[model samples]
Target: MSWLVDKDWWMKTYRGLIVKSMKLSFEMDQQATDLLSKMLDGRGNVIEFDEMKNLFKEYNESIVFGCGPSLLPDLDFLLESGNLRNKLLISADGATSVLINHDIIPHIVVTDLDGLIADIAWASLKGSVIVIHAHGDNIERIERFVPMFKGRLIGSTQVEPRPHVYNFGGFTDGDRGVFLSRTLGILRITLAGFDLNGEPYSCPGKLVPFNKRIKKKKLEVAKTLLKELVSKGVGFFNVRGEPYVL
Candidate 1:
């Protein structure tokens, strides 16, 4: 039988496995929260929900770009597609550099401050809404980079969201871009540069590092989440070579 025929069973099984691993994840998130608290310490502005809603009021379609190596070769096609003009362009952190290099600035960027901070900050300065994520593993990064931003900022957390921080339900930066678009009520979302089967691209040395095995696992989780979103009526299209449908 096809896996889709037993979707409920698979989802339950995945949830059970993830639940067993959530403790460690939660502990790390708590640690990151503590660090973020220290970093913000009365500084920096968080975008309110009303403000975010207002920003996306006119947008209905979004194109979310991931930073898998395959993204580099596909950039030309994406730029030439001509469909980008009217759609809200959302870039996963690392993909910001690529987009910037191609003179295509995203309307929003989802990052863990793990990619090139300079690129992300530049994009923010150019009017891209920066959705920065806080997690235990990137505490030092948040401390170092958060203060460097001078444009629109939105903070997200994996745990409970508060006044300045929000949680939209995603694990990595790439998937977070989708979550952000979905949360904003985008009617359609097209994904590009998402090669879940391959290794994650490496960023600058000072940026957050990448581990192949960990990234692969994260991609699996992302795929599962994307599938869940599909089951819930969210419209998703994959522009990469083969369409990745739920």
Candidate 2:
């Protein structure tokens, strides 16, 4: 009886973990679906790229830039240096305009619209691909803008309501923009100004806060996923503190 009791407890605990993981994964999937639906309501489904063959095309030499405050100082230099204009640019959420203002158009923009509403008008105007990560909070926005976007919109889902956007219980989406770059099969990636620390950088009256704990973890998760891809000879780069391999 004692052994059976212990066995049952262990089984329950293991089952609980499995259940949690499944729940999170489902939630993430749903979030991605909702965001994609909004961004692509009229645009239609995103074309599935051939990850195997296409992965080698232009991405082998591509450089991906994540938007962060640290990037502000060197934004001009980076953009003007012309290191990655031909290479695919993956703009993280809220950084879309920053890149745009500098005339450094990202091939794709990633965000859940937390701080991107203001830029939506111009971004949509430029006709760049936007990947919107969906969450319950933004359903109304999705419903409203999906019809308006009328261009390339990719959606991402998430497992948990982002910590910043929870009240009692609900999910909040952030820029899983890096994922957009990956989906495009860009094996070579560069992450700049992606500092995880929460410091403040200013532009006009606005301040770009550090609060990248969430982003950091998300980026780490992305790195792990890319590792498997890299081992198979996929080219990869992490341009954070120093250029490193995935």
Q: Give per-residue CA lDDT, model 1, range 1-246, as digits (tens).
A: 011113455345334644454433666775776666555546555566568879878988888898876677667776677667678898998899989998988988999887888888899889888887887678778878888887778777766454466667677788878877888888588888888766655644336456766666778878877887787777877664344654
Error of 1 at 113 (Å): 0.9
Return the top candidate by TM-score: 1
lDDT of 2 at 208: 28
How does model 1 score by TM-score? 0.84
Best candidate (score: lDDT): 1
Model 2: lDDT equals 0.47
lDDT of 2 at 180: 39
Residue-by-residue lDDT tens digits, candidate 2, 1-246: 012112343235323543343234445444645454434534453422232225336554445444556667556556556565566666665667677777766666665565555565467667666656565445666665555654455444443222111111111221144433444455555655454344433222222243445445444444444444456454544443244544
What's the TM-score of each model vs. the native?
0.84, 0.60
- As a whole number from 0 to 100, the lDDT of residue 142 in candidate 2 is 61
- Residue range with the least summed lDDT across 10 consecutive positions in model 1: 1-10
After TM-score superposition, the amount by which residue 51's alpha carbon in candidate 2 deviates from its true location, in angstroms, is 12
* Residue pairs with backbone atoms closer than 3 Å in model 2 (clashes): 28-157, 28-158, 28-159, 31-157, 32-156, 32-157, 36-155, 161-171
